[model samples]
Target: MSKKLTKNKKKYRDKISHNKKYSLEKAIEIIKKTNFVKFNASVDIAICLGIDPRLPDQMVRGSIKLPNGIGKNTIVLALVDQERELEAKESGADYVGLDYIEKIKSGWTDNIDVIVATPSVMNKLSILGKILGPKGLMPNPKMDTVSTDIKKSIEEFKYGKVFFKSDRYGIIHSSVGRISFSNQHLLENIKEFMRKIIQSKPSSSKGSYIKNVCLSSTMGSGSVSLDIKNFD
Candidate 1:
């Protein structure tokens, strides 16, 4: 840490005790105060779990719709029947139809966030697994991305539904909202995200399920550690 800190960084440093664990509410406030970016920064959360990632049964993964929608729009691509193309688009899908398969095969998966496909189209998509699987774009039933109801699935993701999966290091990372959002909205989103994580704990995991939680923005002021007990 250099003494030549910017006025904003100095203000944040003086206001926050880095070694101290803050309550969720207090953490959100601190995150808001510390953000010094010109653009509206995304409020991000990282939760460290106690489970071993090497164990298949200990994996934690699921999706949740935050009470308040995430400030960023979720760009969804819906793969459905020709008859359902209109329905998918009406449901808020950014891109719709099986025609996208040809585009996707040409290595054109840019600016797309989530992909929802009906079961009937999954077979056609199977051949493109080599292209989509590595990018985590392949639709799966577990995440509700592969469904008979393409409209419902697309709408859910279009609004706020987000999937979270523990990394190889046992940490789950996701954005709650943007710095421009009200602190209360951000707090509610964080609480809902934490609740989802708690609910997704694997049965095989033992000891402390969540070891640590941290909050930060897309830019500026770094991360603030939060008291895990507050989540319980």
Candidate 2:
């Protein structure tokens, strides 16, 4: 690697190392103690939990509008069959599409954040499995994208439905962000996310599905961990 490239890699590695360990209580304490600059800025925080990956589809996907709102601009994309394209458009989606597969495969997907799609379109796009697949943008039946409810899906996506999968260690990770948000706002968002995850526990699963959760800011600081049992 070039010297500059090597330096950048080292910086990135160092950054990751610094964020690897933290406690939820510490995270909550930070939120409780820190005086946020932005009244409602959206801050990005990650939650890590142990989950079962073998039961049906392992990925959990959903959206919620943090009660305080993310305090940031969010762009939403909705893909539907020709007949339902108008519904997506009328629902106030930033971008609506009847045929977005081609564009998505062509690398045009970099412009968007959230995506909502009807069953038909989602199925057809599955053919590009290799493309949207890696980016975690592919609509999955398990995640509820294969439905005809365009308006409802779009609205939910507008709020904060996140896609999460467990890592090799059985940990699912996701981010919540708004740079200027207050501690209270961040806490509420975290609580809402935890509620959804708890509600999704499978009946067959035993013991703790969520082993633990941790929160951190995008600025790359130490993480704060939360007690999963507290939610119980």
Off by more than 4 A, model 1: 1-5
Q: Per-candidate RMSD vs. true structure? A: 2.3, 6.3
lDDT tens readout by residue for model 2, 110-147? 66766667766655676767876777666666665556
Q: Tell me the lDDT of candidate 1.
A: 0.88
Off by over 4 Å in 2: 1-26, 29-65
**How well is each residue in 118-230 modelled by candidate 1, as lDDT tens digits?**
88888899888999988888998988899998878888898888888899999999988889999889888998899989998899898999999999988657789999888
Output the lDDT of residue 99, model 2: 60
Q: How many Å off is the CA of 183 in candidate 2?
A: 2.7
Candidate 1 accuracy as TM-score? 0.94
On the 0 to 100 scale, the lDDT of residue 197 in model 2 is 73
